[model samples]
Target: MSHQRARGQPALVYRTKTIIDARGHQVAIVDTENPTPVTAVFVPQRSSRAEVAGQQDIDVTRMIVSSDTPEVTSWSRVSWDGSMWDVVVPPAYHHGTRHTRHYSIDIRRRPS
Candidate 1:
């Protein structure tokens, strides 16, 4: 199925990286500069309980983005509905003859 025909919604992708601060401390920085506006569909996979002391509920969702989306990596995250989801692994890229057909990434709700 073509991506254009799919039910796509607007999503923001955030790229994060580790950097050394002036105090010689390592810190992670998140950049939203020139954020790529991609159309994606959020499909819920399953919910599981966290193993931590709080036993928080973790929601696993699959975000299917357009093939044209760029700069997405495991270090990237998606923002939707005032919630931030972390990309758990490398995205699965589906390529067509000329270009990428679609991309799928598994994201999980950030543990509080």
Candidate 2:
């Protein structure tokens, strides 16, 4: 997880990065002046299906919720339904970033 402290705006939470394929030899540096805006969801515990479903009613492009347990390894993906957010969990593992209190939703574009 990363932190962004702008000049005037409040400190913002940034995304978490993991080394995908760092070879034993060379180092490739990617210069990104504009970082992608992300919507992070902080889940403190394991959330039930009902809890996840209830959140769909809100039009939150990026969201995260937590419970008292850590049983949920990944979160269900949420889609924009023109007016609100919709939850969709596919057959594959819906992995998200885990933090001290919640999970993060990383995307190239911010949710509108």
Candidate 3:
């Protein structure tokens, strides 16, 4: 059996994608063809609410650091532990040594 890493957990991220539909209408949809699999390290964050320019108040719940940087955008959502969390912003990539190469992602719990 493979041993699980204490700092890394399996996670899924749905990157933002656009495609043309039947009527030649372009539509933005979550790329489900292949959910990006990533090894994420969960970061504890205090729940906070903030309002964007015209959007409603958003409660940011948690964050995750991953070594992989897919096409995830601010509109992307992360599915973890059977729950979906909205990406708070564009994935932030930190440039550093090989061991520190990772992306910092903030996410909010999706409202029911």
Candidate 4:
């Protein structure tokens, strides 16, 4: 991607915590610590005619950011527009001559 196209706005990264209640049920909670600022491009998923006809309305967003960002795993969550998206897969790294240039992560909106 071109540098101009690659430049993206700042976004927030969140980490989740799982707590077992007194009843032994697992409860997941989002940490309230200040979010990490990362430059990322959020691209909404495009639906084809067949996908639309099949009644698939899954809204997936692809977030592209620098590969050097630390602790960005599949368990990481992205916050945008007051909603959280789950990291759907491992980060895909793009390598240059000596180091990675960027990484892309696909995120799907968490169901309500």
The weakest ten consecutive residues by lDDT in model 2 span 4-13
Q: Cα lDDT for residue 15, model 3?
A: 85
lDDT of 2 by residue, 1-112 (tens): 2232111121122222333465655433222232233343422222223356345222222334322222221222232222212232211223445433443332121234
How would you encode candidate 4's per-residue C-alpha lDDT over 5-107 as one tens digit per residue? 2577777887666789899999876554856778777877643333555454467888887766665666678887678778889888888643347778898
Best by TM-score: 1
Model 4: which residue pairs collide?
A: none
What are the lDDT figures for the candidates, one per model? 0.78, 0.29, 0.70, 0.72
Better of 2 and 3 by lDDT: 3
The list of candidate 4 runs beyond 4 A from truth reads: 16-34, 47-56, 97-100
Shift of residue 84 alpha carbon in model 4, Å: 1.0
lDDT against true structure, model 4? 0.72
Cα lDDT for residue 53, model 2? 39
| Residue-level lDDT tens digits of model 3 in 44-104 | 5656445566555455644546455577888688888678888877777777766666677
Identify the candidate with maximal lDDT. Answer: 1
What digit string (tens of lDDT, one per residue) describes model 1 on residues 26-112?
A: 876667675666778888999987688866888989988777778677778888767888888989988875434778899988865
Worst ten in a row by lDDT for model 1: 1-10
